[model samples]
Target chain A: MRVLALESATRTGSLALVDYVGAPLGAPLNGVRQAAPLREITLDASLQHSEKLMPALIEMLGAEFKIETIDLFAVDHGPGSFTGLRVGMALMKGFAFASRASEASGKPLIGVSSLEALAMNGSGLVVPMIDAHRGQVYTAVYEVGAALRDRRKSLWDGRPKLIEPEQAIEPEKWLKYLVEKYGSVPRLEDNQIHARNVAFLAALEFGRGAAATRPGACHRHAPTLFSMTPRYLRAGV
Target chain B: MFILGIETSCDETAAAVLTDQPLRILSNVIASQNEVHEPYGGIVPELASRRHMEKILPVIQEALDKAQIKLSDLEGIAVTVMPGLVGSLLVGLQVAKGMAATLGIPFVGVSHLEGHLQAPLLEHPEVSYPFMALLVSGGHTLLYHVKEFAKYELIGGTRDDAAGEAFDKVAKILGLGYPGGPLIDKLAHQGNPKAIKFPKGKIKDHPFDFSFSGLKTAVANYVKKIEGGITPSLLADLCASFQETVVDDLIGKTVLAAKEKGIKTIIVSGGVACNSRLRAKLPEAFFPSPLLCTDNAAMIAAVGYHSLKKGKTSPWSLNAMANQDVRFC
Candidate 1:
């Protein structure tokens, strides 16, 4: 199965195209190795996503691969830039709509959490933080199991269990809470969420038939289009 | 040629499919966010954006389905890309870009104001150019001298509140519901338009320019000064009086501009063009049907059809602009 994933929750968004072997429902995780994207491009942060996203995708795909060639579409639904998330999702939804119209059956769409995609950068007691502005950050703490850790690759193998749910809080208060709970938190480095990680995570879900039957999956069983709203954790306007 | 038009400039998520040769609208779908925004008594930009994201695709699909055409059959796409809420505009603009890119078809990013200008052309194709256009909406109140397709010259505009905005603010003060234009128009018919003397908005040096902030403030002051609050009868009078002043200001300025420019034909459009009083007073002027008067994709598609025929297409890098003057090109 081929997955076209987009990460536009932040200013510096990225796109990746990955190929993975499909697995049946409730498949075991024995030989499903994480595959890297065949092509990936990081967009310029200075330009707006509306200006750079589609053009970049067109150039990246070129004549080699049309949009219809991709089996599944994945996007980083956000706790990042609200406009960026909507722009990215709208673009993917448009492509999915067109692809579905052309084919007999529709394409599957998956929405990956922006914070969770960032969590892939760390292992064992991972805290992924995204600047939520207004002197706050959108963050979540994850307990990455040792079995999922791979010494060779930068990204971890399996899903990181959510120890602390996502929330938008001040950096100082969040750190204070983490230190009190976990005691002696590891030194963390700020990292951008790459589309390759998004694609990899989505591939894992797609392999498990999550796109077909998962509770929050955009499309389940049928290949019809659904409204996949951005995850803006901040309530109200 | 079959063209698809998308508009999410503000609270309305609208889409339409049209054929350019005979200028026939196959399907025009508008998913209004009035219910979502009615609680706030005005449009909240963030909420508008959220609703737009949810309805954008479905609305477009419904338009295509009603048109009885496949997405692949569309020759081109047109989308409103400017002079609106940036977040709301981006939803439609990005979707258009993606669909066009996927289908390998050309698309144009039309201005919201330009779409309003092209609206009259859909209903009255014989209406010649070099006409004066009065575009009155919640977002804008302006007079333009339209020389030809894609050509517009700004003649007059509001100094503060737009005409539709004044109606909304006045309606809020009057304890009326949101989208004050239609509500006020309905009530105004039952009351005397001359019941209360509301001052017409005027700018000192700029004769054609309007200033409705003062009028809105005047209505607020009047409502507050009332001893027994407002009765239904009084409310109708207030609605009538307020509507009278706004319609007078709009018609007066448009007529002045038309006479000054020696332009006989006048085209009235945008949300406020749905006002009964405005339409009744401007009998000689060309006004599109109530559906076309408001924000809809049919107007955008009309503009797109003409633009594409002239070989004008937006680049892949076309971005949604929050504020831009009407493009003369």
Candidate 2:
């Protein structure tokens, strides 16, 4: 199976193409210890999501993989750059809708959260801070679970879970709130939504049969088209 | 050659398919969000963007179906990519890029203002070059000296609010509701234009520049001074007086610009061109039909047809611009 992931929730944007090796349908290896992607490609797009994203995807498809071989598409639906999110959503939606016939895995598009994708890199209490400017930051907290050792454990059901819902707040106030709640502020990192992590998470969900339902917007839970909108936190005036 | 045009610059999600040989509009479909924005009195940018996402795909399909063509039949795809609400503009731009790549056809980004300027050419093939264009819409009011396709020179523009915006403001002040142009035009016909003397608000030094804010304020103050608080007769009189002043100002400046440039032909377009008063008053000038007057993809397709002929095409990296100066391509 082949999965393509696009990450443009922040100033920096990226696209990842993964070649997955599937095990037998009923095999224990299919549970959590599935095959890793054979080939992964990520490009730095930084603030040029509109200009660089599509051409890069074209180049990747032409040079590396066939468009028809791709089974699913993923994008980091943002609480980040407003323009960046729109560009990413539009491009992915266009791809999903356009390729609906040739590549029919039912729902082909999945939106990975930038915060959750960033949190995938850290082990402890991970807080991903996306600079919202105006002294405000869009931050989310997650608690990393133990590594999956057997078929009994899954990432979403037993592993990483959101501790605090994402919100746009003052950086100082967010830190203070975190300190008051957790007794200490967790380490903050600007991972900038790596496409590799996004692809990893998306493939795990696909393996767990999340793609059986309708594709969620830019998040993991909801399965509606309206959810694909950019989570700017504040509405346009 | 067949070209598909998509426009989602503001509240309207429009698409059109046209043939290049004779420049015929096979299909021009527009899904307007007037009712959605009616409650807000004016457009809410976020709401408009949300609506565009939902309507864009279906609207394009309808345009293609109405044109009796398939996606594979299109020679190229053209879209308005600039001088619009950024969020709304992105939907159309991204969709067009996707179509161009999938269909293996050329893609070009047309300016929203340029789309309006080229509208008359779609309906009236006889109207040729070197004509002055008076483009008036809710967001803009400008006089352009068009030497030819991709060669536009802006001679005059609004100093304050645009002419269509002035109508909308006056309508709100009079409780006429959203999209005040057509309603005010209808009411103005029942009343006398000479009933109230509103200021023309023309620029003093700049011979053809316009300023409608002061005129709008004058109407507001007049309404405030009325003893009975805007009766039917008073409303009609105000609408008539205001419409007359706006129409007179638009015509005077357009004619002045034409005379200054020694050009006889004038092409009036944009949303305000649909106004009955403007059309009735300026019968000599060329005007697109009512549907073409408002924001639609047909005009963008017209500009696209011309752009393609000139061998001008945009790369995949073309980004949306919120404000593009009105000039040649």
Instruction: After superposing candidate 1 on the true structure, give the runs of residues whose Cα lies further than 4 Å from its correct spot.
Output: A21-30, A149-157, A188-190, A210-224, B326-329
Candidate lDDT scores, in order, read 0.85, 0.80
- Candidate 2 positional error at B117, Å: 1.5
lDDT of 2 by residue, B1-329 (tens): 99999999999999999996789999999999988888777889888887787787778878988999877678888999989998789888887886676556789999989999999988899998999999999999999999988788899999999999999999999999888898899999899899999998767789889999999999999988889677888789999999999999999989988998999999999999999989998999999999999999999998998898889999888988889876544
In candidate 2 chain B, what residue range of length 10 has the lowest lDDT sum?
B96-105
Clashing pairs in 2: none
True contacts kept of 2: 0.38
Q: Candidate 1 at A23: error in angstroms?
A: 7.3
TM-score of each: 0.92, 0.87
The per-prediction CA RMSD against the true structure, in angstroms, equals: 3.3, 3.8
Whose lDDT is greatest here?
Answer: 1
lDDT by residue for model 1 (B251-297), tens: 98999899999999999999899998888899999999999999999
Cα lDDT tens digits, model 1, A181-235, are 8896664575778897787676666555553465334424323354778889986
